[model samples]
Target chain A: MSAKGVLVRVSTYAALIVMALATLFPLLWVTSIAFMRAPERFAGTPPLWPDHPTLVNMVNIVHQQRIGYYFLNSLIVAAATTPLSVLVAGLAGYALAQAKFRAHRLVSWIVMFAVLVPNQALVLPLFEMFSAVHLINHYAALILPAAANAVSIVLIQAYARGIPADVLDAARIDGASEWRTFFSVVVPLMAPMLAAVAVLTFVVSWNDFMWPMIAMQKVDMQTLPVALASIDREHYQNIGLMAAGATVAILPMMFVFLASQRYYLRAVSAGSLTD
Target chain B: MARLELQRVSKLLANRQVVLQDIDCTVNDGELISVVGPSGCGKSTLLRCVAGLDKITSGDIRIGGQRVNDLPPQQRNVAMVFQNHALYPHMTVYQNLAFGLRVRRVARAIVDARVRRTAVRLGLEALLGRYPRELSGGQRQRTALGRAMLREPGVFLLDEPLSSLDIPLRAEMRRELSALHTALGTTMVYVTHDQSEALSLGQRVVVLADGQIQQIDTPDGIYKEPSNRFVAGFVGWPPMNFLDGDWLENSGLDAHCIDYGIRPERLLLQPSSSADAFIAGRLERIESFGGEWQVEISRNGSRVIARVAPNPELRRDNELRLWFRREDLYAFDRATGRRLQG
Candidate 1:
């Protein structure tokens, strides 16, 4: 509409594009390094693209580092965590959203506060509890503790609150029980948010290193991030092998985010806009 | 279908402000009752309380002569259509309509038959496969109605069911609902703040203000003989004009009359005369409404409106005398706002 407006619009787009590249450059650089030979990867002047590309690092990680076992372990932990987290969060969210119970507001406030508490604070207590229960080097030590997430509960509660009370009334009037209403009406209506929350929780659980490292003393029980860190430590000068291990750890989450970006965006926007 | 009653009902918020106070009313089996009020008057809260959605702070509600105050919504056999339609966004119209029945473990064949019949009845048959977001406002409303209808509850609770539609669609749905009530012979309690909707759709209208029932009567009786100034002022568009004046002590003036009230359309223009029901005023403005002109008149620092047939004789700044039959006047107690029963 005006010269100044056009100039501002163009600069805004250019700035966003530049910022996006700046954020994504590290991941791209790691992926490029994963494809290079050790000579090119360890060279003083790192090449943007490998002149003599090789699959040796990926090959070595699979055979020597046993990345396959770690991959399976990560998948098991994430698979165990995501659905359990969604289920527990969904029930808690629905109760918070629809049920009229004493101390409801106080409980919701506590959950919101729980979201702010650092996971590191819980690590020591959880470690102590797991050790007392003799769950060290066991997958249950990792899987069971992640069954509930404060962030997912908050997201679901905010989403479920948007559902009109009358819909529940209609369901109840038709002789549907509270449990049935949750399954039939609330669950279906909150599907998009559930998908987004599941993916986010899965990514968090899969990439988690501190808790898994402390719990799983055995090498076979170690998840991808712990396994990747071990590989980096063992092969300190092998940049290509480290890059390959990092790429494996990062690929699944990238795919998950790409596939459900719409739901993730909508869920995030809905959470921010609600009172 | 069953008779319903709200007896000595009251609702106080946690801060102890009464949102609904000492409400009492009853509907006969298969009768439609409309509750009308301004915003924040607890009409929706009252409807929710009746539908078992809101807890009543005190008092009992009865359906079919049985107390339902302690019962949950499912046990109460009441269906509610919400103001915003509240259709499930992910479900098809067919799924939405059948959800309730399926939840009840109704036979699949029966559920299918009822949904089909309701869709046909509400003209939603073709739209059954479409989701809520795919339909227009009117279609969504019809789907909501269809969902409630399929439940076949003892009582129907509609909360401003047509408020979201366009003006023309609202009129169409109003007629449709009135006709459906007659056909189904179901006890319906509809809530709306729109006077016309309350008047046209209700067999009896309950006017609410500040959580209290002001009047309960048939639409005609309430309009013709409002029980108080609040009801008189609250009902009817181009609301009844109020004039502040002392009762005349002359021979023709009645001793019991306090203030005079007249409907806008009933106030006739007349030349200056010694008529018992006459007011002298200056015409200030005229609004033409196709068939009739609404004239605003000022008299002795008081304003009044009169609906008159379009006329070249009426002009702004002209002195005018407004007259009507003596029987058309209402007398009310200025201190208490209660109408002095004629």
Candidate 2:
């Protein structure tokens, strides 16, 4: 090959290697900090590798910090939020995409506007509403608000747009009722997009720091990120334990994302590009 | 067997533009009719209206002599094959074909028998276990056809079902579709923008332009006796050429008509003659197309084309006189763009 071609090829590989390192560095550093013996983690110059790796920090986070209960709480909130939001948003998306109503355009614009409004602005009013209902510390406070997500609805709407209009028309002609058409035809067609929305919503609910930090005040009911922050507050110098808790919080999201990476990527791209 | 009719159907878009207006055509019992038109001419909209997918703005659609305008698609007993072959991507070919039947609560035995029969007929027996993505474009189209066929509805609606296939595959599936129509003898309304497919598969062709029916006739009649300039231009490849020349002399030869039309095949390259309408021109280009040569000639600032046998002696800028028999010429109303019938 020509010298120019060889140089281009080498540069491409070098860039990819740089990118790979940039991505892997944080995860590796966090994991290393999580396993380091406290002495090594607190050393003036933190060593890349622990002289002796230990499980003490992990066990301490689980037992002493009550990380198991927080982990369970995060799981419950995320699990509840993901499926409910995906289902509701998926139905709304299908309706907006296929069904004709007088207010269709109006509803779509409204949803778009809602997506632009950050959740931070809604926290005060949402907290006030939950307090009046006496469900401020309950799981409903998180799950209910997360269930009607505008971004997920828009993602599903955009994905469903690519499904040829003929298919939906065919389903209508085939005697499938509206709900049956949704569950049978639209849902099956939407599996890839739904998997993506599920992962995203689950990640959002699991890693929600600000809202859960405010609503889940009680220690027993605190979600993982909130409880992790509390642990960090009390053990400011216990870098090992805090790192272990952060890793525990990050692992499930990693699994969920990696497991459905193809679908997640497709949905993200489709949402941004397609009509 | 069922007959389908559209009665002055019209579609007004959200912008309130009349997309389709006064579309009236009928598919008699067991007959296949193709609606041929240019893109965006609303042929698909008419099909959707008939399939109960779109609502008619001011008219009614009748299937089997019963009004279906107010009915839902499911209640209207129509099955459709989409342009993209809309086979459910997630399902195996067998399940894709079985979907409509299962939705209707068809007995397992009956659905199996019908699907098996359709698979064998479409030569898709081997591919039934595969997903739509695994099948070739032709196979996916057949599977879509099979899905509609299994429903066995009163009328079959196909919206450019073969448009997605490659040219060779489209030709093969066209033959298969015609044969299937013959065997089943179902009322079918096929829509396409391709004139050849419409000409070959449909027993009758409805030529539409700008949502209005230009002519409804057999293939031969439509090609030979197009109702207007739009039909003439829209229905043929290398479309019929038009020249806006006034009639110079009208005499005892009964040649009073003007605005003449002739297909490229109707123009003959002959020795010069003293004929009043004989056009003399300089050959601008010659294209040898295997079976024949398509020659373009310029005359009096107008261009005309003639398909002739490959004449190796013919050179560029060669002078030639092309003439058409008066009987072969079509006269159109200059103002109205409609054919002037003798």
Candidate 3:
């Protein structure tokens, strides 16, 4: 209502809009290049929007480079990983948060330790185990290692602490078995955290590069990121083709985030579930 | 309906703390028994042991004449209504009421019938679809009671179920609990730290202090004849006033041999000089509520609190005389806290 307040509000929003544009500029540029004409991509200073847009790069990547196949491979890995990771992480987290079995503190310390151990550092031992088991090229190599995620477990365990022990005891007094109580009471109570863990697993599995690159060495079995890198070498000169492929690769992550964003938002405001 | 029994039921924490010690009690079939204690007195722990929610370090608990020490909560055939209601936050009232029957694998038609009937009985029919978070505290508590009602277990264990409610709602729930107990006539073990709740609602009351049972008696018996000094002080509101045995100049009781306690309400504010015992002290404080007043009288470094009718003429710091019948005085051993017979 005041002149100073109005100016401050206007300038704040203007600054936010500029920052948002800065963050989105690269994705926007790649999307524009994906539709640009071949000659437009080669222009000395490329235009923000292509004057002559075409789907030639998209067609080439799908038909010749088999980007669709690689996309499918990525989808399979992520789809398998999300629910598996959610289940394993949720159960372990709830136990760490509430259950009173022996060595609970020790196990919690171990999980915290695991969270500090970087995923990249485990590549050698993981590769060795997969090699010994003779399943290095299989989808199991991607899904299994990620299913028991320490960070997700920690997130879930912290959230699960909000669940009062009385509700669990009520379930027990009601003749519900431990498994029945978990599915009927605990799972719905932990919905937001589980949803959050699910989206994180999906996005990470979809965009993973180093492990997928080493594990899926076979050309036909490679996931989107590894396959995209392989194509990048041959199509380094063709910006249009590379952008088209990158655009396709970004779709599923966006889709997964959008699909589960409601519960993901709830997770940010968690721990008000119990009295 | 079932008879509940505790046979020297003792609980020891992992740190070697004695929580409950050699507690023995019994509740006849179809009776409502209340356990009352101060916080950390193991009243809730005793209920949990009966519910099989906590394991006793030693001793046996029985329901329906069957030893349930080793039984899981589900197999013990008991229902518990927790202090905070403990209704599943995510479940609607209907689902919460139906949970017990559903988990016991009762047929869907029966579960629905029982849940709806119980909801209607508790006047929760219209709010069946609302989750616990959407309901008021009273509504949540009723839903919890309904859930336990649906179980139709051999015994019901309630752990301070009305403690979270405000004063008026607590009175309402206390009455409702009594009505429910009368209607079902199932063995109910209600635990609360409120002496009035224990006295008003229970057919019998068990008073606990410092992880031990001080007394188990009818409400009137617990009030009229406390077994020890702890029960005498803990059970009554405004607590019993203690007078040093040595301080009373003409008393026949041996000095330092017995501790004397008298209920606040038992003290009279009359100026009578004929009674066997009486106290005179400067009026120190006055507190009034619900048409009754409690005043503190002090003299010669001694204080006596007495609950009496409102006296508009009384002024602070004025020397006041209070009297009690000699028979009203209670004596306990100074060291052991055990009752001393006249």
Candidate 4:
């Protein structure tokens, strides 16, 4: 290889490393502090790594605040939301992309417009509708509204368009019913996008703070993030304890993302249909 | 296996656009019929209607002497080969070939036997484990054909199935398709915009334009006697030359009531002076297409093109005179565009 080419390659790796560190530093620091002794956390010119590691903060947070229960609540919400939303969005996206209808363009426009609407703006209406249905403080309050996600639909619709109408039509002519075609043909072909959307839905549902806080007013019904904030109000001075709580809270999503990382990459560089 | 018939079949989109209107045609049992038209002449739509992929706005379609308008595509027992060869990317060749019967819950042993038998017939046995992405274009095309062939439907609908292949591959597939048609003896409808493809492959050609069928005849009949002006203009290489019928006015004929066309091959450059008539114009340009040269001539703002033997003496901007017998020109009604019988 030429000297110039080697230099370009070296510099590209350098830039990527810098960006990677920038992205990972916050999460790494929180994890590091979670294992640090309390005195080291308050020490002057705080060290990046824990000088003497310990699990006191983890035990304290779990024992004192019932973090496990709140974590379970968050998991339940995510578990319900991800599969339901993916299925709904998958069907809707497939229809919007392939099915011909009188209002096809109109329905497509509505989906695009819905993506632009802020989630904060819908809280009031969503709350009122849920309240009317007597679902406040219920897990359904979180799972129901999210099941019909617009952004996921748009993501899926963009991917689904790449699935040629010929494939769908061929299936129909081959004796597959509409629903069977979707499951046997479209679903398998769209696996990468569905996996990516599943991860995104899980992360968003697990980490959501604003609506869950307002809806789950009962202390025991509160999700992890809401319960963590309540703990944060009184224990603002305990940085190690807060770090421990944050670290535990971040673990589930980390695992979810890591498990789905390969499919996520495929979704990003989507040439699944060709391969 | 079955005769297919369309009686006054019409398709109108929800946007109130008429895609096809009053299309009346039929395919005898075990016939290979081609529907030829321009790109938007609704030829694909016509094929789709027969396959039940698209519903007709009105009229009855019969297969095997049974009304099939209300039957779904699967229940209708019709198979289609799309222009793009729509093999499932996620499925292997074996799965693709077996999909039709598998969906209907056919016996597993029978499905395997049929898929294996077809793979051998199409020379695709070794590639049965491979996905579509791993196959070459011709291999993919064969897989698509195999998928449809395995269905063994009463009627086969092919929408320009070879349109995506290269020239050599297209000709090769065309020959294979004819042999397969003959062997199966199944009624087949092939839709294509390529007129020559229609003529060469079809036992009968159905010409269409402006959302309606123009003419349906044998290849020889269509080329020899086009039913109207559109068929004449659309179904020929280098096209027929249309001249203003008024050019015959000086010959004691009332030309304003008719339009006229002459095939380029019929015009003689150095004719006997005793010919019935002549068209004189300036040779605007000459294009050599290997075996022959097509020369365009303009006369009083009207253009006339003629295909002639490659002549070394033809030059641009020169005066060119071509003579034709009066009987050689095909005449059409001026307003309705219908052929005016001699």
Q: Evaluated with TM-score, which candidate comes out highest?
A: 3
Clashes of 4: 0
Which is the leading candidate under DockQ?
3
**What stretches of model 4 exceed 4 Å from their correct place?**
A1-12, A44-46, A62-66, A102-117, A121-137, A217-219, A270-275, B245-256, B269-327
Clash totals for all models, in order?
0, 0, 0, 0
- Which segments of candidate 2 are over 4 A away from where they belong? A1-64, A94-106, A233-244, A265-275, B228-243, B246-257, B263-298, B306-325
Model 3: residue A72 alpha-carbon error in angstroms? 1.0
Residue B170, candidate 3: how far off, in angstroms? 1.1
Lowest lDDT 10-residue stretch of candidate 4 chain A:
A38-47
DockQ of 2: 0.42
| Per-residue lDDT over B233-311 for candidate 2, one digit per residue giving the tens place of the 0 to 100 score | 7787677867554222332233344466677887777633533345557999998899999999886678888888887
Return the clash pairs for model 2, or none: none
| Best of the two (1, 2) by TM-score | 1
Q: What would the per-residue lDDT of candidate 3 be over residues B1-342, giving only the tens digit for each residue?
A: 789999999999999999999999999999999999999999999999999999999998989999999999999989999999999988899999999998878999999999889989999999999988888999999999999999898899999999999999999988998999999999999999889889999999999988888999999999989999988888888888888733466665565778889999988877445555777789999988869999998867778899999999989989887888888889899899898888
Please report how far candidate 4 places residue B291 from its true position, in Å: 5.5
Where in model 3 is the C-alpha error above 4 Å? A1-12, B245-247, B271-274, B289-291
What is the TM-score (0 to 1) of candidate 1?
A: 0.90
For model 4, what is the alpha-carbon lDDT of residue B241?
Answer: 86
- In order, what DockQ does each candidate have? 0.52, 0.42, 0.81, 0.67
What are the lDDT scores of the predictions, listed in order? 0.87, 0.85, 0.91, 0.91
